[model samples]
Target: MVIPWLSVLWAAPIIGAGVVMLMPRRALAKWVALAVSLLALGVTVVIAAGFDPGGEQYQFVESRRWIPSFGTGYILGVDGIALALIVLTAVLVPLLIVAGWNDADNAAQRRSVHTYLALTLAVEGMVFMSLIALDILLFYVFFEAMLIPMYFLIGGFGADRVASSKAAVKFLLYNLFGGLIMLAAVIGLYVTTAGSDAFGSGTFDFRAIVAAVAAGDFAVNPAVLNLMFAGFMFAFAVKAPLWPLHRWLPDAAVEATPASAVLMMAVMDKVGTFGMLRYCLQLFPDAATLFRPLIITLAVVGIIYGAVVAIGQTDVMRLIAYTSISHFGFIILGIFVMTTQGQSGSTLYMVNHGISTAALFLIAGFLVSRRGSRLIAAYGGVQKVAPVLAGTFLVAGLATLSLPGLAPFISEFLVLIGTFTRYPVLAVLAATALVLSAIYVLWLYQRIMTGPVREGNERLRDLVPRELAVVTPLIVLLLVLGIYPKPALDVIDPAVGHTLTTIDQPDPAPTLADGNAP
Candidate 1:
């Protein structure tokens, strides 16, 4: 009998959340949540170990009848793209559990530690489900449901109760509005498929739908398809929090605890970009193609806008939040470029960004907790008092700027190369963020971690063992992946190629200087 790996992978954290909610002691709840997340990580490792990069497009797939009347099923699967994200989510949650060990204690709102841990696990499980679900309805259900726990995380526990509460509401409202639009698209998809001879009756199986669309078996009016595509893309872009639609992200990230904020930015937000790659492109290839230039323009604008705004931020955490908006632009740019390198780099960027952002944000949170302020002016000469903490913060900062020998560098490099090949002007515009990123990152570090020992900063403590445990792995990953990204690229490349094939996009052929085809 074969193991139902995908089912187990998503269910473990969710079930653990229930178990944690039942724990009598807050300490036990914390340990149990950590263990559960580690178990999930172990499961992901096993799946990765068994997975063949060159094998079937979707692996460890599981399907069962569910709501037969509506043609939705309990479908689950992972391609290399989803698998990479699964690994990212799994790896981060355990560290977040440790990093947030005391974040809920003495909350102004009287939030319990157990409740916080349980909610974290709940978000993890739901995110896991969203990444693996092969049924569109199934994906949407978890996609929207994850927001509830996240809302509570933002509102129920934080240093500033009022700000946290307000941010939580903003987060919920924006995502809920997006979800409602996607609901219409979901229903519209079913209606279109049910009316077509291709599916005979409506079905939510993603693979089946993609196959039918590829084979031209599910034909609909182009305008109708475009509308449905817009519905899906709107939700994803909001979730991706693409510019103009991204107002909710900074406030939410600033008001929440560092762990919760990292969870939102690093893990949860990837779903938006993931949905764009997985659903928007495959299900509505023509619509994606039609919207490519417009999306690329928006992405380039976001890249420059986010970096410029980040340089002006007074709050350290909010500064990092703006930087993410910029990094996300790179990810979106890679996806819409419709080249294998672009998509693969975008996918890899998702993972690299998650690691780097989590590291920088959490380290900053640690510093903030010590000084009891998030303002950049609150500290100077931190390195004199806490060299270990300062060093880690510097490394994470460098990684954020995509410095050479950091994980983000290779991914960012790939995105630029991919973008330049097809859209040189836009790529050139986006590349300007590299200089802008260095400016913000180095300036932030100089203000907080350098300068003569500031008053009151003299007694600051260095990273304790627990803090070291939380940050070491992330830094190591940045170094290892930066130096040798080929292992990750090997797993990611084939899936990217498959996605390109499904959308009928071939890499542009090389040409001679005279513009002759090579």
Candidate 2:
């Protein structure tokens, strides 16, 4: 019998968490967590090896009824997009454990090491489940379940314990509010499926909803359908933390440790974009069409707004948080533009952004740990004292600005080219934000890493062996993907093609005459 790899992948981390909790040695928990996370990563590698690249259908599926009355079940599967994200999740969690190991050992955090490691493991499991879940109810369950661990990760262990607590509460409240709105939409979908001739009975499976909606079996009122779309979209928007809905992020990133910040910005935020693609566009094509202009306007506004605001920020972590807001704008624009290049670029951006941002946060953490500060202006002449650290920061900063031959540059270029095909004005406006992004990144790097050596910074140490281990993988990945992104694009394109099929949208072809003239 074939192993249920998706189920096993999700369960491995949780089981490891339990093992860590049961161990008598508290100091050993970090090693245990690292071991567990690596094991999960190994499982993901095996799954990827076995994954079918040519098919659009869900692979490695496992389904069993959980709540029959509502047609809810423990259904799990992955298409190429889901598989790519699963690999990303697997890669980051182990690195998180490694990068945060010192923080976990500090006197301020020594007592809670087990809890911190366990929560990290559990969050990995929850994110994996959310990515693979086929049932809407199951997805929601894992979606909300992941937050509890992260809430504690922020409040109980990070810098400024009291402020961190407030940020955690704010984060929780915002997400819960969004989740509740989505919960209502999920129920509405359930009811529609129950009454549909195509279903004849209720179903919470995402596939069933997509099929029934495509066949017009729901016969839903246009107004009601719009409302349902609004519910899911708003929930995802809040998570995407789109402009104006993004107030919680700067606060959370400012107060949390760099390790926690990486998880939040790099891994967690993708859920919002993932939901927008998997549910919003696929399940509600009409609503997506109706709302496309409004969303594109918001995205363009966010790209400019985030970059402009980031220029004025003094806090290093908070500035990075704002940069993500701009990056997410690109991701969202790619999805809503309803073109294959756009969708694939947006999906690929999620993975590339995660790598680049995590490198930034981890390297930032090392510098902050040495200097005991996160203020961009607090130190100067870092390169004179810590050249290795300065160099790593330069690569990460260059990646953030989407410098050519880096991973982000490729993703950003695709998004612009795709968006330009249909929304040229918005694309041009978004392109201008690339300049603003460059300003913030280069300016920040200049203030922190150049000039004559500051008195205190003269003694600053470069990245130690462990710190090098934490960031080197990310830098290597940036170079690898920058030069040749075909492997990832291959996995992503088929899934994107399937998504466009569900929405009944096709890529707009450009005329040869227009191309030549341009």
Most accurate candidate by lDDT: 1
Residue pairs with backbone atoms closer than 3 Å in model 1 (clashes): none
Can you tell me which runs of candidate 1 are displaced by over 4 Å?
none
Candidate 2 backbone clash number: 0
Candidate 2 is scored at a TM of 0.98
Write candidate 1's Cα lDDT for 321-413 as tens digits.
999999999999999999888899999999999999999999999999898889999899999999999999999999999999999998999
* Quality of model 1 by C-alpha lDDT: 0.95
* Tens-place lDDT digits, model 2, residues 1-518: 88888888999998998899887877688888999999999999998998888964798889997999989999989998888788888899888888988666662535478888898899888889989999999998888888898888877777677898999999989989998999999889888878777886989989988887777766878788888899999888988878778988888877777888788888887888999999998789999999999998999999999999999999887898899999999999999998988989998899999999999988988898899988888989999999999999999999999999999998899999989989999999999988999999999999999999887797999999988998999999999999999999999999999999888898886757556522
Superposed Cα deviation of residue 154, candidate 1 (Å): 0.5
TM-score of 1: 0.99
Instruction: Give the TM-scores of the predictions, in the order they appear.
Output: 0.99, 0.98
Deviation in Å, model 2, residue 97 alpha carbon: 0.7
Q: Clashes in candidate 1: how many?
A: 0
